[model samples]
Target: MSFDIRPAVPPDAAAACEVLRRSITECCVQDHQNDPDILAAWLGNKHPAMVASWFESPTNYSLVAVRGDDIVGVSLLTGAGKLALCYLLPEAQRQGAGSALLRRLERQAIELGMKTLYLHSTATAEGFFAAHGYRRDGNVRSPYGVETILFWKPLAEGAEPESKRKRFCNCNSA
Candidate 1:
């Protein structure tokens, strides 16, 4: 299905959070052995507040993928180009929504003068990120007991200069 990727507004915060909550619960949590408690805690926890704040912050960039009136996917990028969150509803997976969201975020990162984009990928998403040019830097444990692979990629050449961008987490600055 075709979708439109656009900058998120305040009203879209709730919809974006729902998309994120659903994606994590149904998609990411499955690799964790279908633990409903863990999924609920992760998705039902302070996510709404955090997402609302992100949408309101000047340094945090967020995007939503919309199919008509539905928010099918959401992603957030920090000032330093850290890809803090990327999620698509299960029904929307593999339909270009996630890729479209990523591309839109990458374009924003370039416009913000960022050189590299980083994210911590779940076991299910690591391969996806790797295929998209994000190489694993290391494995890390999330607060919920799941281990994630840290991945990062330098944007296309001539997009931005690495020397000017801040490093994310333990990722190599050079």
Candidate 2:
């Protein structure tokens, strides 16, 4: 399907949240070991306000993938080069949406002059990130009892001069 990827606006907050909620509950539940409470806390209760606030932050780069009017995926990258969140509806999986979102974030990070990128990947997504050039740095315990594996990629120097480029290769599919 054709999709339009663009910077997220304030009105896209609800759609982004919904995408995240559904993605976590439906696609990530197995990784959470079928724990409803953990799922609820992780997706809903733990930091709903914070998540919403992220969309409104100038320092946070939020992007949405929209197939016409439907928001199929969302990703957030902080100024620190940390990949804070990435979620796509199940129907959007394996269709290049996630990869597109990640690439956009990587570009944003490079524009911000960041030299590295990192994320905490769920069990189901560890392989995906690994295949995309992120190296596992070990597991970290989340509040919901889900232990996420840390992954990171460093930008290759000389790939782009610091002054003119707004994108860099993290060595993932580049």
TM-score of each: 0.84, 0.85
Candidate 2 residue-wise lDDT at 133 = 83
What are the Cα lDDT values of the candidates?
0.75, 0.75
Worst window of 10 by summed lDDT in candidate 2 = 165-174
For model 2 the TM-score comes to: 0.85
Per-residue lDDT for 23-130 in model 2, tens only?
888899667777887876676541445556777888789899999899999888877666877889988989998899888888888878788787778897887889
**Which structure among the candidates has the greatest TM-score?**
2
Which regions of candidate 1 are displaced past 4 Å? 44-46, 156-174
Clashing pairs in 2: none
List CA RMSD, all candidates. 4.6, 7.2
